[model samples]
Target: MQFESVSESRLSFVVCFIAAFVGCAPLLQAQTEPAAPHTFFRVKAAETLTAPVSGRLLLFLKPGSGDKEVSIDEFHPTATYVAAQEIHDLEPGEEVEVNADQLAFPKAFSELNGGLYEVQAVLDTDHNYNYAGRAPEDWISNVMALAGWKPGSTAEPELVLDHHPEEDAQRKAAYEKLKGTATADVARLEEFESPALTRFWGRPTKVRAWVILPPDYVKSGGKYPTVYWTHGFGGEIDSALVSGLRIYERMKAGKMPPMIWVMLDESCPQGTHEFADSVNDGPWGTALTAEFIPWLEKKYRMDARRDGRFVQGHSSGGWASLQLEVNYPKVFGGTWSTSPDPSDFHDFTGIDLYADHANVYHRPDGSAYPIMRDKGQVLATAEQFTRLEQVLGPYGGQMTSFDWVFSPKSVSGAPEAMFDRVTGDVDPKVVAYWQEHWDLAHVVSTHWADRGADLKGRIHVYVGTADTFYLDGAAHKFDAVLKGLGADAHFTYIPDRTHFDLYGVGDDRQGLFDEIGQQMWDVARPGKSWKNRQ
Candidate 1:
């Protein structure tokens, strides 16, 4: 069970993002009088801009033969061909090229299929496309039609960033819909000014959350134990409301016992952070334990003691809840984490960092490593995920987010990456730093004699045997470590489940959560027998 586990609009040169078969990029052979010009997509910032704009430039390409607009999104089934070029100043009317030689994912221009395509370019003005996607100030180019574009074609397609993408009205409408789902007094979206975070970011940073009170909250005149929740990567404050509405509906229907749910927003421009206090990510742990919790207790009838505040989450939020339960054992009652990220680094999405000459993208047999799977079928590779992140920009992608949460701050004042994005070589120094500070298995084993008493029986983890991201390997290792230490922790690996559907194991869709709610209720209200009124 051994485990070694972003600044302003700064420039980051993500080199050669295409992995494994990067050499497959076509080379122009000398057969004709003039070598065919390499296929490329040219992008330019608008001339109407008042000042210089600098950030990661992204190009999205999709099939243009259909009437339906090509939707560009993350984690698509048929991965899109994306290319990135970091540009600075990008003086008005000037062009920056994302050629076949630049960083790309799945395929570069020279490797994409020959066809008519719709190509659009986005200037991530604040370098926050991973979090906010195409935000308000982000300069986006209109989709330009490319006819008969082929690998190594002499034709060059161009996109002009003369306008911004449409505002996120759908997201806003969804938020409004969620608010309407419950009574105005029952749910609230609140923002807290964290003294710790404000100082760390050198700005008035606020922690936003959706607090859903119980149905009987005002009428009961009694305190309620709280379930603190958060989301994984690509989630924001709006996501908290969606979760809150679901919780509220369940409580109103009496499918589950009523308890206050505090859906925390852990998403940051730098990534999920997982609420780990880091040199680069700031003291989010301290902000939660010392500042946010106490503030919540006073404002509401919250049973804010360790036994009454239970933490639960999925994926990155799952890791955050587990860390909170471990680090501040006296502050949280317990944790019910589902399909969390790499809890043990020995099988970090299936790569051992401690192994000699560790490589994330390949094995000693010269085979590419698979990062995602479903129904025993490989869906994506580790190389694809990392390369895609490199194309998405440096800060908010899952791999770099782990860096922000786990690694030591580099000389440039940014969180150092644990591995090279281009080479796939694990950084020994960063791994060593991660093991000491963030590796949960090691942290529990090393401090068992000192902190085991408070932590025993407080940790509960649920993962799937067929996790999409190979997270089950780490969970198994960490579970073994816990048993070896004689720590009374609960770890469950549901058979035939993946990361997305671990909770629907039993007859009920949310049977496991009901059990968790029952357990927390018993701790908060001893001998009360507060079962679901189903």
Candidate 2:
């Protein structure tokens, strides 16, 4: 639930139908004419936009009397028969007929037995579908009543495309409310366009952060140390606001030193970019260091030197902070990362992607790999999550998010998938690319001679022994490499803690912030205690 907990809104009912056409040219020709040996399923799509519609058509099938209203959260992609077909040159106000004979089931579902099933369809106009819900431009169809569906049965349903005005209004109102609720201590949203990112994206790309000034800033008029805080996957500016408030409360109570907390927003359409420079995510690390930090230092009364700048984050953000300190040792003084995503691919969530015949679904002993749970009980397996994400569309899931930040860009403008979706086959070539570029342990161990001096005593990591995602396995691997290299790194293993409550120390859920803030102060002003402050 690491990435899943960020968005509570149920996934919009969106399914992808990947049809295998034995004869491609004949299938296109058969759109106008009928072809033998082809099972025909037809659908009609009505568009609401003025522009022509072009995207995939998703078909979902469920057995028996399906739930009257199905949320994407309740729907299991593995249990349902999902397929997709592309519709092109579809005009608005025109209900176009689509030939379903061209659609084919995935290899796993190819041999499914015919039976009574409930069906639904969605027209993804933008081609970007995620679990968080649909954009205003996307369209969905009503669930078809249960009916007998056989391989050759010619059953067609009509689907209408319309905007969810209520949902849109709700989203807009929530954002407006968040903007209006900012306190005096928690500064308003600050955003700027990064030139490096803009050039890479071929458009103006905005980077945003919340700048929380210390109490009595104008009266004091003194430079303060800065903490660059980042959020985990699916997190937004609002998520950072809570942390900013905690920092303000602690400063006001004299529990911590007065410091400027910069809560950075790393969430994007692709997923949490984690501010790592990649071929897919562009030069985020470079933009953050070369552009965002410099502008922030000059704009505010900040201590711009390396000793005064610190980094901290959890989960994906944790990985980001760790990478930032290791990659640019001179830029930031230190990083305190907690329960970060896989630091070593060798133990990436307890599965080695580089191992021979490695499958994400099963172990070498053929046992399932656990994904989400509490205590020792397994709530979901890795295959269930990955396969579910596959049917949810190609964008905005944890697995695809990693590919976006780690894998090389393919000619199709999408990141080359690191594993086969159906078979869970790990591609060694992609693993090699990951190791040479984003593998934190590999990078640090290989380049210790050059970076070791600057990075010594700067790297600190913590993970729970019972992390919900099994992240501690990778943390152990990473720590072992650092130890072997004689690096002065700190790795803490908290007993009985999980990913969700790692920040808590006893009943104080926000205790970690106080600890991290003080640590930053110690690094900034050595031998100086909070007692020495006025």
lDDT scores in order: 0.78, 0.75
Candidate achieving the largest lDDT: 1
Report the lDDT tens digits of candidate 2 across residue range 206-283.
889999888767677878989898888767787788667667777878777888889999888787788899899899
lDDT of 2: 0.75
- Report lDDT (Cα) of residue 16, candidate 1: 25
Superposed Cα deviation of residue 290, candidate 1 (Å): 0.5
Clashing pairs in 2: 17-83, 17-84, 18-84, 19-104
How well is each residue in 60-177 modelled by candidate 1, as lDDT tens digits?
7777754222334444524567777888998888887777445666665675667787777888888877665778888888777767877665556778888777866897887787
Residue 458 lDDT in candidate 1: 85
Query: Which pairs clash in the backbone of model 1?
Result: none
